[model samples]
Target: MSDFIEQLSPLHTVEREEITKAFREVFALSAGKRVLFWMLEQAAIYQDAFAGEATNSTNYTLGRQSAGRRLIEMLDAVDPRFYPALLIAIADLKTIDLAAAESLAKQQEGEEYDVEA
Candidate 1:
């Protein structure tokens, strides 16, 4: 095997500490505000997926399917070609951004403001 191929191994395991440091270093080299905004977007997607129309449609449903089939279902909402990886992963987030979600709902309704003043 070539030198490059000799060192390459699929069994390589990255330590948690090293992964954390690498993640932080990557973000530090770029803009923090953009990442923050990206986080908000992920939160909105999460809210819509878990609490909005998406959730309602799939609620109280039980079925069994292979992991590949489930992946295709998630891909329906998010295109893997565009978003291969999230800036701030939200699929496993415990909470949603209510403010961001509310704003998204309003934008979809074509109403500027619904507050009665």
Candidate 2:
């Protein structure tokens, strides 16, 4: 549909097949890959929006935060290999502190606060 295409055009750069392959390679899908797939796509969508022409600063910041949140969500659901890649990507979006992810996990586990850099 034209409306659907128009809405999605700015939020996607990679082709569908490429994205599918990326999902397969990164997620390995059997072990909680669905959530990873969803989060990765969400992050990509936000990045795409931020990268689009005529995009405003507000939209860019919103998209970056959306991507960051999705990456954080993926940290909980995805593989260990995913974490550092996500940290870099999140940092590229201007979010600092990969340790926040670890801290959040520890907080959830009711562990004593030991913030690592």
Candidate 3:
């Protein structure tokens, strides 16, 4: 047997330290629970695919869309504790602009001040 072939094993057991730190910084207890629950749910989908109980394409695609929607909904409200993780996840998300978000927040703050005047 080839050396490379012998190494066929389970997924890499890498510790998600950075991601965990990001999670701690971005979410409160309830939000963190939601994130972890979603993670486990998605992992189960992967497990099903690996076991041939689910299709590769359909389940993966649907799972990803579901996860993304849930994450977006969780992040839609401005919670400072969770904003950093959202920013990290959205770093490469071209559809959402951080600068625009900041500007809109500033505008809203200005409106609130004006209302009080």
Largest TM-score belongs to which candidate? 2
Q: In angstroms, give how far residue 114 of model 3 lies from its true place.
A: 70
| Candidate-wise lDDT, in order | 0.42, 0.55, 0.54
Arrange candidates, best TM-score first: 2, 1, 3
Q: For each candidate, give its TM-score against the true structure.
A: 0.25, 0.26, 0.25
Which residues of candidate 2, in runs, are more than 4 Å off? 1-31, 45-53, 57-80, 83-117
Clashing pairs in 2: none
Model 1, 44-89: lDDT tens digits are 4323233356654444221212332353334333345313333333
- Looking at model 1, residue 79 earns an lDDT score of 41
Q: Model 3 compared with the native: what TM-score?
A: 0.25
lDDT of 1: 0.42
* Cα lDDT tens digits for candidate 2, 1-117: 557546665447246446546654755443334455455555554354554565686586677668767665545443455655554454543343456776787787775445455
Model 2: residue 23 alpha-carbon error in angstroms? 17
Between candidates 1 and 2, the lDDT winner: 2
Give per-residue CA lDDT, model 3, range 1-117, as digits (tens).
357535645342123334445655545454554465456456452343342555766577666757655655544433344545545544434345567788899999999889854
Which of the numbered candidates is closest to the native, going by highest lDDT? 2
